[model samples]
Target chain A: MIIIGGTATNGIDENLSKIISVPLLKVEHKVFPDGESYIRIPQHITNQEILVVQSLYPPQDKHFVELLLILETLADMKNNKITAIVPYLAYSRQDRRFKEGEALSIKTILNAIARAGADVLIVIEPHKEEELSYFGKEVKIADPMPELAKEVSKKVEKPFVLAPDRGALERAKRLAEQLNAEYSYIEKERDRDTGEVRIKNLPELRLSGKDVIIVDDIISTGGTMIQATRAAYEHGARKVISVAVHSLFLDNAYEKLINSGVKEIVTTNTIPQDPSKVAVVDVSPAIARKI
Target chain B: MIIIGGTATNGIDENLSKIISVPLLKVEHKVFPDGESYIRIPQHITNQEILVVQSLYPPQDKHFVELLLILETLADMKNNKITAIVPYLAYSRQDRRFKEGEALSIKTILNAIARAGADVLIVIEPHKEEELSYFGKEVKIADPMPELAKEVSKKVEKPFVLAPDRGALERAKRLAEQLNAEYSYIEKERDRDTGEVRIKNLPELRLSGKDVIIVDDIISTGGTMIQATRAAYEHGARKVISVAVHSLFLDNAYEKLINSGVKEIVTTNTIPQDPSKVAVVDVSPAIARKI
Candidate 1:
């Protein structure tokens, strides 16, 4: 098997190779003065399994174009067994049209990806499962929650997993069960007229001296995580830590989360970032199991 | 025939509708919080001629993604006779690989555009003509030098056309012939080892009271144009004007060109910009002729 990394997935290619024991294919990604993207794979591979590692993070559109170019180039070289491992699939949030004339972005992006000649797609915790069914080709989803739970267990004492909102309750419950710790989810009530949101937690259970760990699929903008951190502090929790599968960290979100009193932020190496600042645990073990 | 304009080609849609006398389709292009592009045509397009006008300029990748989304959406809607009218086709410059393993971005982009379901393509002044034949589908190239020359004739007095370098001499000659003005091209000698460039102009030609117009296909960094303008000034040109098919205007390029003594700059409505400042001459007339 050969591993190819996109522009953003620069150093993770070596890490993936270490887990899977595959040769890495070098790709030269170039961006012109006009903001157009170009990529070149120095060698050609035929009749071999190829794995493309690209996380659709910021500059998602550019990375997406580069991904398509790589896929098409591989197809041109007659590589049939191509798998795209998009850790954080952009456009997964807009799985459904919110309004009458809204475009379902996820569906369009999926079709584009499939048409660009990816035989199989392996995504790590896509925002929506129903959107995966929309792709006509083979798809394998890798869940890193178990790995996240293991990391959480080693870091904190008497860990209590908390979901920021109801949408992530399943993730929180699974992680808590894996760690043999207590789990609870917060309810968000929004005043439609005023556009105000209130976070509600279970009144019976107390979080006084427990290390609270918040688990979610993605941490974009960190608004919900910030509120949840403050709520945990108000409930007299000893420590607060934020854990997510994908760390988008948009618009000063990392700083905002830290300033909001979260003890630490841990995420998988799905999207590349500074390792020292944001704790990026490896997800290659989980990915290696599937391959 | 139905014509639709993207975010960059806003006002130009109405102008095309007037020239070609076709109803314009409305497209709602939205960028989601997670940086995903969404585009909706609002109404279903059936068995009719469809034309989409979009320019791949700054934010080229996003516009390219949106263009693909629009094309794929049209395909899903079963629109067969879809034509893409990209006034400024990005990635046209990187038509071929400079190195052994470099990606032919234009070829990949063309294939992507075709797969996304464009049956025909219409472009104005793409950087290279040879690359257009690589597309399996039909392609139409429109040259609006006569129109740009007309715009220049009205703005300047006793105009003298000057090509930035040897490559653009054809454009300068055509525009000069149309305007019935004197024309000259700058000679560039590059040091093979050092890769340094020197611009040379004829010492015999005098431009003491003539308006000098420098014509080129694209004005990327404004370095060549600045040098050409300086050379024109040294030859005693009274006023200097710059003309291009596509205006990329990279990093302080507009300010650099203005500061270099160009009186005014004129470009076609290819790349989107403020009409009051950039002097975007309409290309609807040229497109209307092709339709």
Candidate 2:
């Protein structure tokens, strides 16, 4: 297998080395003044199975475009098989058309990626699993939340896993099961028009005097997490920690999380950061065997 | 005069009513899941002097693109004159070409807005004055920092304006003079490669037991303000406040500032928010005469 890593996937270089003997190739991206982008794969992979890893975080379009360019380049190079590992798929939120005349943009983007020459696609805890049909060949990765929670449990005594909202309760429960800890979720009501979220069932959780870890799949605005952490602290959680699979950490999310009573934040290498002091687990090894 | 308010400029609606008799118009934006955007004006704007008030805050590209699309649509509608009131211009940090072949992206974006049909462009204390040339427009709005400072003075007691960085010191001094308050600045060293900034001269300021207000043109990442607030608290500031002409509080910046010991974060209606407490001081009476 020949591995091609995008900018966000650069950290995977170390992890890939531990499991695979294949050489990891770096894809170069050059963005132009007119907002045009060009991508180049460094190694020759003709007739070879290729694994390309990229995270479609913010500046989402730009990164997604880069990935598209790479897939096109790889396909033109006649690579035998191409697998795209998009840890944070950018358009996952648009799984359906909420209004008339709006394109099923998520489907469109997926089709674009598939047409650009991806034989297989991998996404982590996508917003809606039904959308998996959008991808021609889908490979879903289990949430790394369980692994992260277990890791946190070893360091902190009396740790509990917290899901910021009900949508994430199952993931938190799984993590709790792994760590043999208690689990709970915040009941949230979000106003779609304004993007405002209100926590309703937060005060019901028994959080007093316990070390809590708020777990979620992604941290986009960090607004939800910040509010949840504050509520946890108010409910007497001695220290609140936040863990996520993909730290989209959009905007000034990291700073906001840090300031919002969160003692520490742990996330996977799904999204790269300078101060990412958490377990960097690779789904590639598990993925490689299946592919 | 016809008023066009962008999302951020919504706060200026009250002031516009007091100054002008014309009805205020709104530009609507629709963002697709695939990160594509569309914009439309509420009514016909043919041959009218249109002033668009928009603050380019977080999800920076989304807001910037929405502004651009509005400009394009208005131009297509043959508006007599178009003026963009951008209180907080995003991408101001990338004013210069740090690397060869790199786009002066900010300039390119400005030119795109101009091409989209802006007759005049108004900005509040742009990162650099010379950037005005990039707009290719006939009218420009320089620092309204002094006007904003006067407003702050009326609200606070013996407030001193402190520039978060040396680059902003001149504006701070201008505000200090207008408010009859002391002025100071922190020297900053920025990493050219990563766009990370570090404050070097923060410790030298003796803000102990004094009410300190940090003033700047724009707040994007909020890192500088966070540092300044921390340094102020360490130096014994009784209370720390922050004011900006354009609060392009990107991401979760507003929440971060509030959590970081900012007693109050006051910003002009340059950007609209539920938390926005200050509206732009209409220099329109003065500005209208010049145009």
Candidate 3:
């Protein structure tokens, strides 16, 4: 059995190999003069179990194409045991066709992965688990919430976990169990007429002197997290820390969160993170245990 | 039948519709704050022939993803008679695995397009006709050589067409026939010992002080065109003009061609072209005749 680290892994594949004690084969890649992606596997492995680790980081489309090429090349090599590990699946949120003629983006992406010949699939805390059904393979979930909770606890003493909405309540429950702290959720109610959202139920707990850590799966734009953080402060929480597995701080979201009185924004190495912009905690150990 | 222009079309789709006398429905697209590509098709027409036009320009992978989304979205809307008109087919050069453990990149791209549900595909002068086989469907080629010849002829009198190599002899023959000019090919002989190539046959035409034109399928990096231009000037030609269907002037190739004393560089609007960099000729009329 061998593992091949793809170009889009963001160094997480190296850590995954170390934790799992597996031989890792790295794929060499470069761009041609005409701006085409070129990838080549260095070592030849025949008829053996192979793990392909790649992430859909931005230049997300380029990374996604690399993953497709890697999987298809492995399949062409007669390696039917290829397992694709995409840390954060791109286009996962575009699963629904809310409008008249919108693209079923994740359906197309997942179908392409299957067509690329990945026998098994693994992803880290996808936006929704049901979206994985589009892959049409034996899919495994790699949860980084528990590990994130454990890591964020080191920054704040006695962290109280909170979920931004009901859909993310399970993530908060798992993290709260890891930290052994009280957890609650903000009930968000959207005005159907105006499409404006307001938090319905902020817990009336005596959270005056406690540190609040809001946990979720992905934090892009930081809209919901910022609102939840403000609500926690309104209830007299000492500090507000935002934690999630995938942190795509799009459009200066990290600065916006900090400006909105968020003490610290912590996330895993799912999407490539800037250390100075957001605090990163390792989630490779959690993935290693799953694989 | 109606046409829809994609974001990557670079005005070719609009010109195509105008030339073919078909209504054009432009696709609405934007990038989300999280760096995901979003596309929506407005003005749906059910059970009609839909022509979707896009190009594989730089940031090619993103454009490819958009193409897939458009095709699959049309398929989902029960539009089975969808025709995908991609001006330039990327990854076409990576058709063969020259080295061990290398990807047949074009094979993966073709297979993904097939899975994306494009019923018919029309491509402008591909790298090789056989590369289109990876698409596994009936593909129509839109040759712009004759049209480019007529356009380039307006600049010089009594042009002599020359092929860079034997593989591009057919392209030169077509263009030469259109201009009623004599054409010859440069024979490239590679040293089996060191893999160094040198031109064996430079045309020995009894032509002193006449315009020489070099035509090929694609002009990428402009290496062969520059070499052929110098050879033409060495043969006592007055001026050298370079022409091709697809112009991917990668990495200062246009400047290199100019520095080599090329009088004019002409190409079609297959890939996105800067007006100041190279002169673009219209090829939409040829495609309209085919369709």
Candidate 4:
């Protein structure tokens, strides 16, 4: 098997290459003066299993177009197999229409990827697994939560896991089980019109005299993380660590989270991550196992 | 047919609405803080023919995604028919791979639009008519050349049409015939690596003692137009006019062309043209005929 890393992959593809012990193929890519993406698979390989690693990070539209070009070009090359690894699948949150006559953007995007010719699709902890069904092919998820839990355990001996909301309680439960600790979720009521949220209740444990870790699938604005950390400190938690699979940290989210009194920031290298500021965990081993 | 205009339509849809005498539908669109596009079609219409007028201009991918969403949603709403009008089709210049192991970007993009549920696709003067074959469905082109020629005839008498290269000689021929004038093309050799071009030879008539109008399908960066205008002046032409169907005028192109001794800049309102600087010709009547 050979790997081809897209320009937006950050460093996850390199990690995957190291873990899988496979050679990474070089791709020559450039943008024309008119903002058109140009790519070429310089090496000649026919009937070989190929893996494409790309993450739809910021500027998602441009990255998505490039990914489509790569997939289409690889499909025409008569490859034995093509697997697309989009660790941070942008637009996954728009899996369904919230209102009348709304478009399911995630569905449209995933379907287009399948049409672009990917034999298998792999994403890391998509907003919902059901969205992958639109791909119409074999789908796998690289869950970094277990690895994140392991990393947290190495730092804190016994930790209580807390989910910012009930929607993410299961992730908190899984992490707690791995650490042999208690888990609970906070209740949050969000005003759709105003985009404001209010935490309804705190955990039963009150997190008193205990180290707490908050887990979620993604942290876009870090708004929830900030609020969750404040609640943790109010509940008498000794230390608060915030962790998410895909840490977007958009528009001062990292600084806001840190200012909100987070003891440590933990996130997987799903998106392009800054390890100096956040403890970046590697999920390549888990992804390699699935592959 | 009811018209639905995207935000990036640049008044073309309104022109289409006026020409077709159809009521335009209301669409509310916004972007989330996380940079996801959200759209809501407020009105309900079923079993009515729908025309979607969207121009894939600058920031092309975002507009393309919105087009897909609109088409997919309209398809689900049981519309009798859906016709997509993309005036300035982006990525059309990449119709085919110029080198081995390259992606046919235009084909992938066009195919995706069809897959997104556009029943009939209508584009305006695409780079190559052959690229539309990738749509794999009913297709129509709303050529604005005739309308442009008519408009130009009203402005200048006895225009000598000249194409920058042999590739666009056909366009020059059509424009010249509409004005009852002679047509010729310049020979140009382009350096693929540096994207530089040099005019090898001027027209046989030397363009002496005649008003020259240089025509092309699209003018991006205005590099070719500036060079062609200089060549026309060097040949002792009385005045030079630069015209194109889609006037991108990117990166100081407008200023550069005016400084290059162009008497008039005429272009269709294909890519959000600044009407003050260039003589904007309307092509709505031409598009209306096909609709």
Summarize candidate 4's per-residue lDDT along A190-258 as a digit string, tens digits.
788998888876446578878899998999999889888988888888889898999888899999998
Best by lDDT: 3
Q: Give RMSD to native, each candidate.
A: 3.9, 16.0, 1.9, 2.3
Query: What are the per-residue Cα lDDT tens digits for candidate 2 across A77-118?
Result: 764698888877776765664543233446646765786678
Off by over 4 Å in 4: A189-196, B189-197
Of the true contacts between chains A and B, what fraction does model 2 have? 0.01
Candidates 1 and 2 compared: the better one by DockQ is: 1
Computed on alpha carbons, the lDDT of every model, listed in order, comes to: 0.83, 0.69, 0.85, 0.84
Residue B21 error, candidate 2, Å:
32
**Candidate 4: residue B78 Cα off by (Å):** 2.9
lDDT per residue for candidate 3 within A231-284, as digits (tens), equals 888888899988888988877888888988898888988788889877887778
TM-score of chain B of each: 0.94, 0.77, 0.95, 0.94
The runs of at least 3 residues in candidate 3 whose Cα sits more than 4 Å from the true structure, single-residue gaps closed, are A191-195, A201-206, A276-278, B190-196, B201-207
Worst 10 residues of 1 chain B by lDDT: B96-105
In every candidate, what fraction of the native interface contacts is reproduced? 0.58, 0.01, 0.77, 0.61
Better of 2 and 4 by lDDT: 4
